[model samples]
Target: MNRSEALSIVEPHLTKERFEHTVRVADTALTLAGLYGESQKKVEIASIFHDYAKYRPLDEMERWITTSYLPKDLLSYHHELWHGPVGSLLIDQEHGIKDEEIKSAVYCHTTGKANMSKLDMIVFVADYIEPGRDFPGLNEVRDMAEKDLLKTAWMVSRNTINYLIHKQTSIYPDTFHAYNDLTKQLYGGN
Candidate 1:
């Protein structure tokens, strides 16, 4: 579907602020796609739908988690990371987006997994560095994103882990795995 169609599907599922943020992320993902020579259509689709389940009722998200057969242990982590993976399933089943690449990019956007695709990196970093986002050290992350998307992805992965640790919250295993793989690539260690 086109941008408006995609947004229309998700618009009722998000708050006004989140809808605006989603649009910014889609725009940023398109920019990154242009910069990194990835598929703009896939990136845009994934970006717009990345948080499709973000505002779902907790019970609804839990039901999706179980029905989709995602790791039950996900329940233990903060709910902030649930939307990406759950939204993947929601978009595919409810919105007719079956392309595995787009689904995977949406799935990996929150707490990136190991072996992310170029499209995945674009959605992931765009979600983090979207112009509507503001956080400590955001400028540095945004700068890193502009310079190198993959390295910026690794930076976001590492930074997310640090943030979770600082908050004394559980860090998802996929996040640590991504951090290790990206670190090995960026720092040259096995």
Candidate 2:
């Protein structure tokens, strides 16, 4: 779908603040797509719908996780992480968006998994480094993004893990896998 059509579909599903955040993420993802040689259409659509299921009721998200092909382990983590995987499924079931690149980007946007594709890294890093967000060490991440995609993603994963550890919250295994995978790519193992 085109940008306008995609935005219209997602706007009603998001709060005002989140809609604005989604726009920022799309813009950022577009820039990264251009830099990283990814398909702008895929990146735009995935970024626009990244939060499609963000506001779904907790029970509904749980139902999607339990009934759909989504990983069951997500139920053990915070409800905050459910939206990405559920959004991936809903985009297909509800909107007929069957592109695996787009689906994978949306699915793993929140907690990235191991061996993330370039498109996945674009959406994932774009969401974190979007202008509206204000996290510690984010500027460094934003800076690194222009120079390197994989390293920037590793930084985002590292920062997320640190933040969750500081909050004493559960860390999703995929998140650690994202960090570890990127680490191995950037620094070859002995």
Query: lDDT of each model, Cα atoms only?
Result: 0.89, 0.96
Q: Write the per-residue lDDT of candidate 1 for residues 1-190, one digit (tens) a residue.
A: 9999999988998999999999999999999999899988898899999999988888888888877777888888888878888888888889789999999998888889888889988998999998887889889989988789879999899899999899998888999988888888788778
Q: Which candidate comes out best when scored by lDDT? A: 2
Model 2 weakest 10-residue run by lDDT:
181-190
Poorly placed runs, candidate 1 (over 4 Å): none
Q: How high is the lDDT of residue 20 in model 2?
A: 100
- After the best TM-score superposition of candidate 2, give how far the Cα of residue 115 lies from its true spot, in angstroms: 0.8
What TM-score would you give candidate 2 relative to the actual structure?
Answer: 0.98
The pairs that clash in candidate 2 are none
Model 1 vs. true fold: TM: 0.96
